[model samples]
Target chain A: MTYRTGTEAFIQGVRTLIPLTPGVIPFGLVTGVMAIEMGMSPGMSMGMTVLFYSGSAQLVALQLLQNGAVPVAVVVTALIINLRFIMYSASLAPYLHHLPRRWTWPVSYMLSDQSYALCAVKFSSGELGRFAPHFYAGTAGAMWLTWQLSVLAGVYLGASIPQTWSLSFAVPLSFLALLVPNIRGAASLGAAVVGGLIAVFAVTLPYNLGLVTASVGGVIAGLLIESIRKKALSNASTNDVEREAQ
Target chain B: MSDLSLWGMFLAVGIGTFVMRLSFVEIYGRWRIPTLLSRALVYVPPSVLASLVLPAVVYPHGQGAFVFDNPQIPAAIVAAWIAWKTRSTVLTLALGMAVLWGVKVIAS
Candidate 1:
């Protein structure tokens, strides 16, 4: 894509992110409050908003810190929690690999769950062109800005919010909202079941290593099932071909 | 409790997170990962999300013990069903919070 065309793609990407803002806003608000409750300053919270830019990881880190976990522990926990971003980055690489290094760095930095979702939708729909990275940059940039602002709002308001309302449930509820529909296939079911059991059993692991282990275990189970399924299908096809020859 | 220390922690987290994210791009460009590794990546999100959510659902405190005495369990279960049925983040959260608060008030 030409420079002029890429510029348009960037604008298109920013537009797609607008609808996602409302969903991100409340999550960020919760993260900011959680940080404050954990004894972190507003500046520190906002810095996390800008830098980490991940609501789930930020919330998990805050809780870990509150538990008096060491810095290494907190960081490792967040990394394990966010390991999926590597997959997201890899998925988008084909679309964005040719972009300038400066372009790739910031765009990758801004990538998150919602932005990646939007990008995937656009890319699959054929709406995205060679300048798709520009579009992604726009979507991610908007999300990043809105996410930071929402956290800042929460930091200012979290301390004053009444305790009568239970906001803590919002976190798990959000995940439930995201997770339930995804448990569609046998692969997903196997993964979730194995992962859940492992997490419950390994909760005592320091720095939430149970999370990493459970995730690895779940992924392994899912992949194994899928591979077996593929192999079975291939074998059946070969047997059919032999019968036809007879 | 120290302000400077908190900022230091924030910086550490922020920098650490960035470096971790950057690793996927920097390393993967030169080295190709196996197909099994790629397939495993797909399950990471669900497992990680479950790990994050289960702890909060089962134990509000950092402890390993379950809080069956608390109402958060029923509230969360109801909310989980709502989430599954409607697939709406806002509604699920709102319902869960309302139930949790209502239970807390009645119990207390």
Candidate 2:
């Protein structure tokens, strides 16, 4: 839908994000609860939350910290988890580069998986016109508010809960939820399998280096499978041409 | 584990992450990303996430040993299946937690 004014587009952006909030709220709450449960003071929990502004990275950092991982390892692993943001930044750069530094800086900082997904679709459709950035700000701003408030709620609610609930398992479960949707083809599936197996075998690695190793191995496996598939398709096409000539 | 250390780690990651998010936007015209790197970026999420999920589920207690009978294994499987089918984070988490609790209750 075309918007005559920036406000209309911004409102539309917020509306588009509402449906996705249900998926986000639980993760936010889990991140908050996990942080507090890891013995972080509420003040510190909010500090990390606001600083990182990333649920997956925050959770992974917490998990590594709980495992007695070194600070350097925790930082590396968390940064690795947030690497996908680089891809998002690249994808949205063309659309956002014309904006001022002030707009570009905060907009990039507010980039989340959900906001990227929403904005990518809108930008590609080329419907938002001059207000594309405004629409993005709408979605990103709403998402930011929703995330912080949900996490804040969880922080307050995290205490007084018994330890028997095994709430920590939700961390990995959330990762699994994120993982499944990414496995769309054979290459990605191979990547995940290799990555998972390597992690399990390398669990004994010090400083949580297994995660780094597995991630690299998985990406390499995916590249290998992708090239192999391409070669097979080319070979089959060549065979078809030879038969036609015969 | 001290407050100072924790904040340091947070600052490091925060700065690093922001730089990454701003990388292309800051230099879009000055630099072109390598074609191979762009292609491989698609696999990063799956690889990293699986790497994280598998270990967490297989070795629930972080004992550095995989336990075949870990309740988290089955719970994670069910959750993975639910995630694939529903693609709903809330549902996946709700069912996974419920399954873990149910399995624990039954086993005890």
Clashing pairs in 2: none
Worst 10 residues of 1 chain B by lDDT: B19-28
Q: State residue B15's C-alpha deviation in candidate 1, in Å.
A: 3.5
Highest-scoring model, TM-score: 2
Give the backbone clash total of model 1. Answer: 0
Q: Which regions of candidate 2 are displaced past 4 Å?
A: A235-246
Task: Give the clash count for each candidate.
Answer: 0, 0
Question: Once model 2 is optimally superposed onto the true structure by TM-score, how far is the C-alpha of residue B92 displaced, in angstroms?
Answer: 0.8
How do the residues B1-108 of candidate 2 rate in per-residue lDDT, one tens digit apiece? 689999999989888999998999989998887778877887898999999999889887794776676789889989999999999999999999999999999988
User: After superposing candidate 1, which stretches have Cα over 4 Å from the reference?
Assistant: A1-4, A124-127, A231-246, B1-9, B23-29
By DockQ thresholds, what CAPRI class is model 2? medium
| Top model number, DockQ | 2
